[model samples]
Target: MVNRTNRTQPLSGRGAGTREAIMTAAERLYAEHGLSNVSNRQIGEAAGQGNNTAVSYHFGSRATLVRTIMAKHGTHVGVIRMRYVKAAGDSTELRDWVRCLLRPVTEHHAALGVPSWHARFAVQVMTDPLMRTLVEDESLTRDSLCLTLQGLGRCLYDIVPPEIRPARAEMARHLITHTCAERERTMAEGLAEPGASWERTADALEDALVGLLAAPITRH
Candidate 1:
């Protein structure tokens, strides 16, 4: 008997490479074309795989494919972020905290070739319910990223209200997300203009975020 479902099983070696190709292409296309607009067939084509069934085999559905992509990138970025966050000593300032939050994504962008449309794509994915749930599940485990956030919270314990620390942390996360979206957009637009270095963008973003997150502390 032939196992028709064998193609759907997890790939390894060269097969793993092929699956990664599909995922990378899907991410690029979905980020470029938007999730709703990009189809399984389109993703397969972009991935250089002739079979549309690869998407089903690898991810089960279009929604799952997008989720997988988000999970891959989000987890990678989150791990790098948590390293910096967890390493900060007792003397970490608000700006150092901001750097820990901001550096991973910017550094990745600098290395991974920042997309011209990533800002808009980020805004969409962050706001989308399905994607948000996927992100929360894949990246924000209590022992992982959440613990890092709690550490930051501890650093600011003297300045922030104990009762509202969770709320403030949530707000800070949103502010970082939205600010990154805007920075990506500004970079996309400003790349053709003068003085568009990633360093400059990172600095400006860090300044803006420091203002947003630290303002409350100053008021207190």
Candidate 2:
């Protein structure tokens, strides 16, 4: 029996290009229309494939296709994160670790330029009940990300009370995901504010996240 999940393994030349096109179309459609709202056939059509089953042929099920896309972007982001992690060294500052955590993502989006769909697409996957686990699992496999997260944890161990850490962590996740999604959407629609460059946005996110992670826990 053939493993459909490994179908993309030997791609090259025209086959590789076709696979890339299908993934690109799927990412864009899933970003614009909700993941559940987009169909595999629609992705095929968007990718210029005449056969509606092109997506299934190339990537198997919806979960596999989504995982493939997430893996692509996640790998890219993880690579960029390693650069930041190296630069951070053994710095104990909370904001340095926060920068290590957030800048890779912002830098990836920034390098992709305006009108890119990845940030919003990631938010779509992260927020969806059925698909969220896929992203979480994907995240755990990234060594650089895990190290950065550990750095953040170490920085927060004394500052944030152990009991409320989980809640604050959840809040930080939402802030990073939704905030970047909103910025991407506004930029795509030409509604971004006067000074909305990715660097400035990253700085703002870094500030907010630093404060959020280090804020005094008020226990009544």
Candidate 3:
């Protein structure tokens, strides 16, 4: 799908620094406070842009800024996931494919370490009616992701109800996003569950997701 042209193109040369700064700051603030609460002026001030209009000049609108951040993280996650997908070639085991689904998320946030903003930012965009479509268009639908879903479908075969597969897939998406966001928030705040780490969380999530996907569908 052709990407819709961004209303505000990021500036080149020295202005690029200001643009990046605003994006980073906006992401952090938006993650800490809900999107509706954060404003362009606050984002501009947070980025240290003396000009109050900095965010307006750089991003045009809040939704545009949100999409930029989602695309940034989505690109990184997609690269790592594609590599995993390649490694899982022809493997029908549920765990092998589930790792492809879960690891990129946990691993990316893990690499970002504490105070990462993308997970929270993602949840916000997903929950919002308008912003959710922007994210799904730019980041969620991709050949690599579709390929992974195909692999999972192959793994489940005739076990899962075909009619209900879409419902189950959506459930899996919600679980991973919320779980990781909460984990990121607590870990950043030093409230992580008793010596827990992203690695351990990934393992636990992998186990649960595998069971969730592979569990037999009970027909009424």
Candidate 4:
């Protein structure tokens, strides 16, 4: 699905710098505060723009800015997932496919170092009434993600009933995004567990997601 948001011409020089600064500031602010709670004027100010309309001038609306950030990070995560997908390679083991699903996002968070906000930012986007639709539109278009889903489906085709697959997949999504957000918040506040790390989180998520996807669906 093409992003229907308003597009700015490819920026150059200082214009590009300003746009990036605004996105960086917006991501951090939105991650810290709820999306609706943060204003474009505040985003511009945080970007160090003297012009209060900087966000509007550059990205137009909060939705467009959010899309831009999601697209940027989505591409990075797609790249990582593609590599993981290649490694999984026709493996029938459920855990291999589960790793393909969970590791890329956690690995990206690990690479972002401490004080990163994208995970938390994603939680807000995924949960927000207005922005939630954008997640499926943006994410479903990725080739790597498509392949991972296909592989996961093959693994679960016999075990998990078709009707409950969607619910389990949603559960997996919530588990990954919210847990990562919590970990990011913990680290940002200097309250992280001693030796706690994204790698460890990925390990745990892989185990939990495998169980989720492979569990039997009981009819009520």
Candidate 5:
């Protein structure tokens, strides 16, 4: 068997374009078949390359490729979330922070025309411990959302106890993840149903998120 780790044969001209094509194809395939099920060869084939080398040349490893796709997209998302946090004007209220954290993701899904595959991909990342670890290690940074989350925790600390802040953050993260998953499922169902609109779904989701995050914080 060919060494799957080897780089794809380099294109003679338009190397950058070829690399981008490979990345795009890999992202789509990974979203469809999942990280575990998809192989480098398959990605190359989808990218219009002759063999698996393209994936290796551009990304070095399967893990890196997945991380790259997420970072390229997720970093932009992080920026949007950070902007919302900045706009909150130092309130640091738990509900406000929660809304800021969630708004960007939900808006992105709404704006991008949520594909059915995105939900499945997100669900896999949410539940898989190894994948989560990889995400933290390779995709996230200290100054990124992780720091922003810590800041949010400090803001919430005024209301919730120190020992429990970690737990609360975890709970909040799960809540957001589940909400997104549910939104995707709703979208999938709505596509089959008559008169389904993303705008309606986004409005309802925003309302539900505010209620979900607000109730707990207000109770404290």
Candidate 6:
């Protein structure tokens, strides 16, 4: 099993196009099937590379390959989120910071021009017991996320009880990530109900998160 304990830098760009093709193919395949089930040779064939060793050459191991794909989209998501975070100013509103946290994901998938794979790709990483923390730290941790978390936490401080904050934050992360993955899958399959859009999804999620975060905590 490929795990975070192995840290290998994929040889950069002997053939830039081939490397991207491999990453794209791997991301799509991994999103569809668990990464544990896919093989390097399968990813190589999907990338249109005839050599069975192509994935091993470009990316040292499956762990490195998964990191590469996460980094690919994460950079853009961070940049987009930073813009929203900066735009948010010092507002203490819960929904404002929630938007900062959530919109970048929806907008990123939307910008991918439909049938995007990254959301589902991300859900797999989030659910994986082995790779989850590694990818979360390496790819998903951004200055923008930190800033948004700081801002959001400030808004929640007066509302959420201290002991329950961490659990609530975890729940919020699950809701946003999984919900976006479901929406992306539905849209890709042409099964999204009428009137569904990324913006609307974000709005609904923001509403739910606002209430969840602001709700009173009861000690058992």
lDDT of each: 0.67, 0.88, 0.85, 0.89, 0.64, 0.86
How far does residue 219 in candidate 6 sit from its true spot (Å)? 2.0
- Cα error of candidate 1 at position 210, Å: 1.6
Q: Write the per-residue lDDT of candidate 2 for residues 1-220, one digit (tens) a residue.
A: 7665546463889978998999999999999998999998999999999998788888878888888888888889999999988988888889988988899989999988889999899888988887899779878879998889888888887787778878988998999999999999999999999988889889999999989989976767
Residue 41, candidate 4: C-alpha displacement in angstroms = 0.5
The C-alpha RMSD of each candidate to the native structure, in angstroms, is 3.8, 1.5, 3.3, 3.1, 4.7, 3.5
lDDT top scorer: 4
- Each candidate structure's TM-score, on Cα atoms with residue i matched to residue i, is 0.77, 0.95, 0.92, 0.95, 0.74, 0.91
Candidate 5 residue-wise lDDT, 1-220, digit = tens: 6444534444456776777777777766665566788888988898899865777877678766666666656776787777876777567565566556667777666665745445456666657687778776754573446655765666656656666566655666676677666766666656435655544554565566445533454344
Candidate 4: which stretches are off by over 4 Å? 1-5
Error of 6 at 75 (Å): 0.6
Positional deviation of residue 203's Cα in model 1 after best superposition, in angstroms:
1.2
Write candidate 4's Cα lDDT for 1-220 as tens digits.
7332455554899989999999999999999898999998899999999998788888877888998899899899999999999999998889988888888899999899888999999999999867989767879999999999999989888888788899989899999999999999999999998999999988888888888888866777
Where does candidate 1 clash, by residue pair?
none
Error (Å) of candidate 2 at residue 124 is 1.0
Off by over 4 Å in 1: 1-10, 114-121, 142-144, 162-175, 178-192, 216-220
Runs in model 3 lying further than 4 Å from the true structure = 1-8
Error (Å) of candidate 3 at residue 138 is 1.9
Ranking by lDDT: 4, 2, 6, 3, 1, 5
TM-score of candidate 5 to 2 decimals: 0.74
Candidate 3, residue 140: the lDDT equals: 49
The window of 10 residues in a row where model 4 has the poorest summed lDDT is 1-10
lDDT of 6: 0.86
Clashes (backbone N, CA, C under 3 Å), per candidate, total 0, 0, 0, 0, 4, 0
Candidate 2, residue 46: how far the Cα is off, in Å: 0.2
